[model samples]
Target chain A: MDLQTLTYIVVGFTFALYIGIAFWARAGTTGEFYAAGRGVHPVANGMATAADWMSAASFISMAGLIAFNGYGASVFLMGWTGGYVLLALLLAPYLRKFGKFTVPEFIGDRYYSRTARIVAVICLILASVTYVIGQMKGIGVAFSRFLETDYDTGLFIGMGIVFIYAVMGGMKGITYTQIAQYCVLIFAYTVPAVFVSLNITGNPIPQMGIGSTMADGSGTFMLDKLDQVVTDLGFKEYTTQVMGSKLNMFVYTLSLMIGTAGLPHVIIRFFTVPKVKDARSSAGWALVFIAILYTTAPAVGSMARLNLMNTIQTGEVGTVEGNIEIANVPQWMLNWEKTGLLQWEDKNGDGRIQYYNDKNAEFVAKAEAWGWKGNEMTKVDRDIMVLANPEIAKLPNWVIALVVAGGLAAALSTAAGLLLAIASSISHDLLKGVFMPDISEKNELMAGRIAMAGAIGLAGYFGLHPPDFAAGTVAIAFGLAASSIFPVLMMGIFYKKMNRAGAIWGMISGIGVTMLYVFQHKGIMFVPGTSFLGDMGPNWFLGISPNAFGAVGALVNFAVATVVSKVTAPPPDHIQHLVEDIRVPKGAGAASDH
Target chain B: MNKTAEQYWKANIRLVSILLVIWFACSFLFGIILVEPLNTIKIGGVGLGFWFAQNGSIYTFLVLIYVYTKRMNALDVEFDVHED
Candidate 1:
């Protein structure tokens, strides 16, 4: 079958599978709606969490970002995974023991203040809404590219899929559907990787292949060969390029770590497990599943970069005949070029595509002597690397179709998870917890579904008309979660004396400073031309980008909360006892409405 | 809090602290701060630092969580606080 038809069939099959699972797992009660009846097995919850956590960014963009950034992108690999340690060790068990439906409920009950819960709700909404917009956009992009449809039609379809599963089955449906999604995405991701690895290094495992010698009898290690090839083209060596100062990378990694732990969507998954011990082990399983993709990603990135360079520089660098002739450009390049993500121009009218680091001033004079005008590949969007990997490697059309399905699965799974988080907070925390304390169980479940539908509508609208800061929304979401939610939750569990006033002020100040810093650098709400202080290194505080400032905000939160609690009254006696109760694992019953 | 419960909490804290230290050393120390010096050492085709940043730390994190889970479960039983 043709590529387009195969993609349609594979994607259609996966959608049918998800809708089927949704029907099989329709939630019947408030407990099922919010916490999947608190009966999910540890391994199953772990798989669901993995699917929920690995968004389109992880599945689609991470490898490409790593390819271009080289060693500097290790921040993402380490930062994203390291947070699970914190989640497993410090947060998950305690939260599971508390047996709450939503994160804000824990905050409100622990601090004995509705205001604290509201602050948490605001933080959760802000982070999750911004995060969901990115997923919605990813869905649109994947649909448009694979289905050969316009972005709007793709987004509407994605929204319809999410609505069918999320509104009907709630967390119960999302959990099972995400398990199926994890299987699809992981299979799609690794199959191409395994093939590419064998082609590149004669090893089937991508992780080991990246560390092995080249398969062409070149007697050179893959990394050594990649470093040599790119450095010869005036790019930095692939193995040791730092992102910025060591301090910046340090803070940036820390920010992402805490942010991952802080994300409400990920945290809520633990609540579905049966026991506190399961919660801890469940996080381990989640990390194991996530690490499978995370480890393979670097290999895919390095090998893809090597393949791309080898294709362009068919011969030695700095030679007249080194570049590929325009007429002989690969079919893959032509295919991607039609998507407008990969473009090339025959600079200097040489009729050859020269892909190199043209901005390297030391290489400029040499390039002139070599009769090169500039780097001919003008717009190689990093997002294209994974989507185009199979085509670039000449893998089967089925593999390519599988990748399209995988990308949609990643995007849809995460979007559903975020929408669920938003819906639960509004229904469980806002409507039932605060506005309608006397709401019937059936009425509350209905409210949760309606809220979920509304969230999907809002997310679809945002996807159709993404904001200017859509590109930067991930960083903002992470920063907000890191600065506000993670610190407060940690204090609530670990520090028995943290009072309402302290928690409230700490959240406001933490998120406040983070917002101020990000807005100053990225523009107020990312309005174009509004970043009064240009987003340059010299203007940054301590040479830290706004994205990396979350850790600092978290530190400030810890400090302010500690000091404020010292001077104010301690938490009430029963609240301190509640903390003690959560610390132990015994008598943890099913997640209750009370 | 009861004495055994206090001890259990203390033990949990101590285990977490030690694991967190290892976590920091693997990712932040070897991966970032000491990356330059560690890059001088090679494992196969990979720099030790690069391997830690991208691969080793993730493996270690997985191991740490499992270890914690086993130890804490044991502690829960010993302290008579384990769920039925």
Candidate 2:
């Protein structure tokens, strides 16, 4: 079968599987709707959590980010993975013991204040909505490229699919579907990686393949060859490039770490598992699964970069034959060109494509002497790296088709997860818990479904006009979560004396300062040209990117909460008992149906 | 709090602090702060420091969490707090 037909078949099969799972797992009660009846096995929950955690950013964009940014992008790898440690050690088990349906429920009960719960709901919505926007856009981009549809049509189709399962299944539906998604995505990710690894290094494993010597018998490491190729064209070395200041990288990594742990979607996954010990061990299993892709990512990134360079720079530098004739360009390049993601100008009236660092002044004289006008490859979207890798490596059509299915699985799974977080915060925390405390369980379930639909609609709308940082937007969500929600969750669990006043003020100031810094730099709600202070380094508070400001915001929260608590009365006795109760593993059962 | 619960909580705190320190050392210290010095050493044809940043720290994190789960479960059992 052709690539397009094969992609349709594979993608069609996966969607059918998801819809089947959704119907089979349709939730019947509020407990099942919100927490999957709190009966998910630890290993099963871990797979679901892994799928929930790795969004389109991880499946589609991260390797591309690493491909171009080189060593500097290690911050993404370390920062994203490191947060599981915090989750596993500090957060997951305790929260599981608390036996709550949503994060705000814990905050309200622990602080003994409904107002604190409302503040938490607001913060969760903000973080989750921002996070969901990226997933929606990712789904659209993946569909448009694979199915040969316009972005808007693809987005609507994506919304329709999510609406079917999310509205019907809730967490129960999402959990099982996410498990299937994890299988599809992981298989798709590693198959291409294994093929590319073997082609480049004669090794089957991606991690070891990257470290192994090149198959050409050149005795040079794969990374060394990549470094030589890019450096020959004036790009930084692949192994040694620093992203920004060392301090900035440190803060950026820290922010992502804590942010990952703090995300409401990820934290709530643990709530579905059977026991407190299961929650603790399930986190380890989730990381183990996530690491399979994380480790393969760097290998795929470096190998894809090598493959791209080899395709364009067919001849040696300073020679006419070094450039590939436009007619001789590989099929993948032409394929991506149809989507307007890859383009070449054929500058200097040359029919050959010159992909080089024309922006580097040092290479200008050499390029001018060679009669090259400028780099002909004017545009290369980084996201195409993973999607195009199989084709570039001359893999079979089925393999290429699998990649498209995998990409869609990643985006849809994460989008559903974030939408669930947003919906639960609205329906459970805001509607039933606070406003309409007299609502029936049946009505609450209905409200949760409505909230899911509304949240998905809003996400799809924002996705149409995605903010400038389409790929990096998740980091901003992480910042908001880390700064605003994480500190409160941590304090609520660890600090018995942290009263309602302190928790409320901490969330407000944490989210307040973090959003202010981001808005001043990135714009209010990320509307372009609206940032009063430009995003340049000089405008930053301490040369930190707006994304890296979360750590500082979190510190502000910790300080303000500590100082406020010093002056405030201690939490009431039952609340203190509640904290003590969550700290142990005894008497923990299936979450109570309030 | 009961004496047993207090001690159990203290043990948990001590364990978390130690594990967090290891976490900090791997990602923040070896991976970033002391990277230059550690890069002088090589591992599997890559710089030790860069490898730590890209690969090693994640592995350590996995191990740390597994160890924590095992140790914490043991602690729960010792304190007669294990779930029924």
Candidate 3:
């Protein structure tokens, strides 16, 4: 039961489960393929939606980001999950009543314009592809680290799994698999959280661990202790306001909300349930499920922060210093050492490891005075924490294996959903809605499968050649979705006067501006040589960073749509009747076939 | 039936407004603007604000949803439009 071998078994089993589910739930009709036959139980759909929504970004990177950043990172946990409110109240029910298979379908039909549908399709693809890229990269990373495989080889294996289920299952297949995935991922996330919480604060419930007191009668919260420890090593206080601008934090939170609203996979989940009320209830249930993982994440971060500090910074671990001759490290450290994620240097000629902030000037002076070059801990990949948590805690090898499966589950479940969204948009929205009106259901289903495989290849390519924002890249995609898609969708559902022109214009402007802003910041297509203009302006109108610009884009969407609609003629009565029908579940089953 | 439809729509709007006010207050106001002041208090060793940032607000959202579903279920009954 070696950790690596265990990881393989767990991940392999989950993949089998999904592939099996994919075949069992193989979509028969266009209706099932697109919307799971519009009969997905609310609770079942809720679990699936939760899995679809919580990507690798949620499972791998979030806690590590929170661990390193402290209280400021709380914004992500709150802001991102809070968006279920917008989904539940404003979007889900009406969209379900609209009974459309795709977000662009709603736009095309509602706006009475092909141009608007095309624009919506473009937005969906851009947002979803960017989001999927990160998940693919994450899957590759998880496979390599846990299974001890090469990065490229691991990526291929990961892509193969996604290809199996996503290509076979379509929405109906992916939906059921996603439910299983939700269970795996949540269990994987919470178990370690509980263990870590217990280790640090004597609390098994991670929700309490973030603020719980230390057992040593220290008279201060664990976070305060963590603050003191890191600051003692020249890092900032864990609870202090971000040393960076508060405005950046505000914008980042806003962008994330906009992205949450815009992501296509999540929106599509709402379309699966039977009635508008079910949609509303499904959102609520999804939020409840997501909250289980979200609430525990901060606790995991704080606990890991404290554990890492306790293990590395005090006594023989630090005092002996200077690599500790690489012999004296624990078995877990030695294990991680092989991954190149953990390293040591004996700069001071001392035999131990020095773990402190090398970037801090005073710490550099202190370390130099203490006869060292600087901090020697090199290449701490943020993903190592979630991947290696069971090993770090000296938990069972099976738990470690389960973490691997969980990580893959998280990545593949989301990737499957994204691929389906992309495929449907291409086959149903683009081909059917725009190019070919007379295509048969059989051809369309085959086209959907082909499109899915094509998307998997694109995602696999990104995984092999990852972009710089490695960890936070998916979050950026989330922001794009929030800023661009969510606003236009809200208008379409609730704003009776919003015309097709307004919806079309608003969505294009929202997505386009946000992507342009992101391109400028992350560099044109994330090509390494970024220029001054893209470095998150004072350049970005009022000091808004690129990450937070999604909210601004959404506001622009709302503004443009409102203005355009006000100046336009009213939508035809049939469209208005469509709206009224969407308001309740009276004719929900009838329209559910779309 | 037309009158019932009108009543159903009005009821929906009213419910939305009330729930929306609470939603905005929790997520935007307390979770963001008024967070620092709120953090001064504690619930079970966790900061009131931080708890809201993590768990409290989500809990409230759940409660709000159940409440909405129940009230809407009643509204459906009144309109004779409850989904079977």
Look at candidate 2 and give me any clashing residue pairs: A315-A322
* lDDT, candidate 1, A1-594, per-residue tens: 999899889999998999899899988887877789888999999999999999877888788878887898898899889999999999999999998899999999998999999899998998888788777777776776786666688778888877877788788988999999999999999999999999999999999998999999988999999999998888999988987778998998999899998999999999999999899999999999999999999999998898899899999887868889999998888776765557899878978888889899998778888888898899887767888888888899999999999999998899889988998899889988888999898988888788878878877776665542232456567888999999999999899999998999999899889989987987776565788897889999989988778889899889898999999999999999999999999999987778
Q: Interface root-mean-square deviation for each candidate?
A: 0.6, 0.8, 2.2
Instruction: Quote fnat for model 1.
Output: 0.89
Candidate 3: CAPRI quality band? medium
Tens-place lDDT digits, model 3, residues A360-463: 89777876766666776766677667776667677777877777788888988888889999999999999888899889999999998898898888877866
Per-residue alpha-carbon lDDT of model 1 for B3-75, expressed as tens digits? 9889999998999999999999999999999998998899989989999998999999999998999999999
* lDDT, model 1, position A325: 94
Best model number under lDDT: 2
The candidates, ranked best first by TM-score, are: 2, 1, 3
The DockQ score of candidate 1 comes to 0.91
Candidate 2 lDDT, tens digit per residue, A1-594?
788888989999999999899889988887787889988989899999999999998998889889998888888899999999999999999999999889999888888889999999999999999888888877877887886766777788888887877788788989999999999999999999999999999999998988888999999988888999998877788988887778888999999999998899999998998899999999999999999999889999989999998888886987999889998888888877876768889888878987888888889778889998888899887877898889999999999999999999998899888888888888899998999999888888788878888888888888887764345788889989999889989999999999999999998999899999999988888887899998888888768888887888888888899999999899989888989999999999878746
**lDDT, candidates in the order shown:** 0.88, 0.89, 0.77
TM-score, prediction 1: 0.96
Better of 1 and 2 by DockQ: 1
